[model samples]
Target: MSEPQTASAVEEERHASWPELFFDLVVVAGAGLLAHLIEDGDGWSSLFLFAVAFGAFWMIWTCFTAYGNVRGDDARLPTFLVGMAVLSVMVAAVPGIHEGHAQAFAIAYVVGRVAAARPWHGATVVVDLPVIQAFTGVLPWIVSFWVDGDAKYLWWAAGLTIDLLQLLRAREDKLLEGAQERLDHVAERRREQLAAHEERARRDGAEAPAMSARARRRQRRIDRLEKAGRVGRQIPTSIVALRTDNVHLAERFGLFTLILLGEGLIQMLNAASGAEWDRMLVVAWAGAFALIVALWNLAVRHGSAGVALLAHGAIPVRVQWVAHLVTSLALVAVAAVLGVVLAHPARTLEEHEVLVLAGALALYLLVSATVHAVLARRGGGVEDGRRAAWLAGAGVIAPAVVIVARESLSAAAVVCVLAAAALLVSVVDRRARLRLTGARDGRAVPASTP
Candidate 1:
């Protein structure tokens, strides 16, 4: 069972403060705008726009996650300011995503990352290492635009990858420090409890009154010390912080997926208005949209739910978040590609696009299922892998149904099948819950008659 929240605890934690919420909103809007800019372009320009947009989104999220993990407090106002700056750059880059604003976008992104790191740097004692490391790593990339013509992107990718890896490492270190602190507190409490028990025993058996009084005093001291140690142990660890951070990351991914869906919808609306609403075109658009929704469910709902369930002790919290973040990005990349394909004039789905989407979906489901299985095994239980198998099987069957029965099965019919499958999963979840409740009741003692 979870601990109850008190008013003081609520005040101290301040997880839902205004500034933090505002910062999240800014990220959502910025991501949507970036997706919109990419969806409005074509061919190589479209790809470039996507790269620039993704770069911006990735930089912002990385900084947010890194700082949130390191600081352990929202520090909302400053975070909001940084978010606004990112949004400003995204707005400026919207006009010429491919050519005119590339340099501006890159500079803004690099500066934003640097700025976000500053607060965390100030808070830590070993600040110079990360600061020097960040600047030294980013400087070459910032300079590469002048020196390298063909491999400029390589410089950016390399620098960004280093920063990301460093962020993960820092988070891992923080979690280790936290676990050590908790262990120390627990040990201290155990010592005090033993001392108290011994002193109480001595007091009870003591023949001399003076000796008994002394023993009582010592017992009181031990009691106070033990209480203090227990309180210290109650302080939440960095692993809990990482779990909350990953939830935020998952929410961000969900928002981006919605934005991609919106982009697809806008493209379809434009196509429909242009009198291109033939049967094949309509079927293609519907399939693309359904694919986007499935991808979103795979990444945000199922994937995140699995992570939240598994992130207990089987893996380090920081590693779990990093893995989830990578998976989320891969899903977003796949969605971006789908958005591009949907926006184009082509009616038939390309083999490469289908393969990419299918592969990403499969990988997402497989990773999540594996994590769940590991967590269950660690807890001396087992997860029915059948649910994961069902989802993956649906992913394969849904596309095939759309392709083979495009003319016979309307989009609404396909949607109904998807809904029915979702309902079936819901039924399974309900049955599992009932069984769990029954097990809990079996362990409960009957109440005495009133």
Candidate 2:
């Protein structure tokens, strides 16, 4: 049987608001600018620059989105729009990222993070301060302005790492607080129960009831250990996990994924329209669309399950955070590849294009595999393990297919190969899901589960 839902869980069913949607539209513009960064560049330098720049941009989104997730309806519209406007300045700076615009980008990012870190108009910061402490990550970015050459990217990477680590640390801190609260409540309940038992025994004109054998034994052990100074005695405690209402946050991330996919599709379509219509181009377009659909299937399935697990406190929030980060970054990189693929469907794939596509596919699947592994470890069943293994296998193989086929295969054929691999993975994932559901229902395995 399922656990009962809390009132907070029921209340968290609310969807994203219109102001949030408006905020996302501005993000879409930023994504487009980031995509163009690597459209014509070669080698890992372009990829590295794109990753760092996009990391900063993603952090900006994280700051505002984190604020919105906590504040909910109280999150101001003007504040979001002002952040959006700052993001626009950041987006405008993207085209000249390596030129004179890097400092502008860093400035906008810092300004945006500061603005979104807490409430405006003299609101009490005590309630929301811990939830939005992302501004501290900007110190490295501030130092990057004076640094020249590739060393600046090192600072950018450090800043993003700090932000990511801070998020994880904050999550740990909240968990500790929740666990302490739970421990205190348990101790209080135990005290009340003991008092009630003593009163009942007194009313009966007899001695207080004896403790259970197991409790007595455990207490004796604790006493012995304390006398020896080997262990500190503590109240009854079990594993306590911090559970919060993550439905809104999950939905927010899901929407952002959808927007990334939409932007990718738009890039593909725009590229197709610009190129001369040919059979190979049509084939490439179809393959690219299929790849996107497969990714959507994977992302949606994992995202929905993740949101459920989050609601139940079955997994760490940091894992989900990292999953979304990897998913978004991979999709952005794929968008850049899609633009290149559609722009020259008949031409041989470039070295950088092959590498970028392969890397993105590999990174995405590996993260998916990690997510599934985490789910399985949290009692999501053996089927989850099977899915993780399959995803990991595909992550390894997909890149090999890209790397090997790039030499002899046309761009369209290479794309088809990737789409085929993704489609096969999707098919396996669907079968595994069906079989798992059947098992849970105490029914026969479905005929389709080969």
Candidate 3:
């Protein structure tokens, strides 16, 4: 049995405040607008535009999420509200990008990101701060305004790509710095132990343990390290100021997933209400609802293990950040596709529509699978590989299902197929988890167990 939680530990557990929940409303609206934009557009150009806009918007959300995770209840409500306002402007500009709103979009993105960067305003060190690195992409986005035609979008893509590259690099730097800090602390403790031994021996009139040449060199190096104050410099007050509440951070991401699902359902219902009533449309709606339920269960139930891995230093926090980012994009893409399908359930699915839906589902499963696989490899003590593999296997099947059925299936049939795949994965994953738990408890539980 686990130990009981103490009052201090209970108090330390962070939770979402009202301001943060209010901030999520902006995401709901923004997701709906972006989905509508996609549903209304055609060809590769619109897809490209969506990519750029989504990147900027995603980074903005991440900035504020990170701020809240770091600051907890102390996070400034006014700053989040301001970020929300700018994000709304950015979302509104997305639909009018070609109608002289491109500049407005660009300006809003820059301002929104800067406002989101408020949490890291006075940082003394830049090594571990991916937010600062993410800001590097803003320059190109701002510069895109002066450029003409499609060439301008290239700038936007470049900016977003730069932001991703910087995030990855900063993640590596942080991991290395963290490892070095642990090594330095170990050496410092050894040095102190040796000094204490010598002092005690002298006081007791006993001969101290003889120091080897290697030991002497180690001590000398540690002495120089102490004098140089390298360890002190490595640990800056800024890190404390930016201390993250890992569980709360995970909860925030989970909440965002729910918002995406809720928005998707809203869009589906709205489309259903607008469309003529039909059996196939109802089937499609049912499948979509089931899909949303499966996704929610998967996110809320299993996602915390990955976050715990992040908190315990088994994985870099950036890994979690990037994973969550990709998951968000995929969820939005799924929502957009579902909205289109729900709007015209009687019609045959378009090739691009099939591609988007399959790709989004596959992306979500693959990303989640990868995170869980990492957790298992890092010794989280659950046999996550089977679940990870099951999700990945289902992910792999999603695109193939589309490829084989694209010519024959109705839109509703395709959706139902995907929903069935998701549900199967969820069921199999849960059983595997239960089996693992029972085995760990020294029981031979039936595979038929829930």
Top candidate, metric TM-score: 3
Compute the lDDT for candidate 3: 0.72
Model 2 stretches astray by more than 4 angstroms = 1-10, 120-131, 170-244, 301-314
Question: How many residue pairs clash in all the candidates, one count each?
Answer: 0, 0, 0
Please report the TM-score between candidate 3 and the true structure: 0.78
Clash pairs, model 3 backbone: none
- Ten residues in a row with the worst lDDT in model 3? 1-10
Which residue pairs show backbone clashes in model 1?
none
**Superposing all C-alpha atoms, what RMSD in Å does each candidate have to the true structure?**
15.0, 14.5, 12.8
Candidate 3, residues 341-386, lDDT tens digits: the string is 7888868889888888888888888887786687678775555666
Q: How much lDDT does each candidate structure score?
A: 0.50, 0.71, 0.72
lDDT of 3 at 5: 18
TM-score for predicted model 2 compared with the true structure: 0.77
TM-score of each: 0.57, 0.77, 0.78
TM-score of 1: 0.57
Cα error, residue 33 of model 2, in Å, equals 1.0
lDDT digits (tens) for residues 4-78 of candidate 2: 121132354777888888898987888888987778578778888888888777777866776676667777998
**Clash count in backbone of candidate 2:** 0
10 residues in a row with least lDDT, candidate 2: 120-129
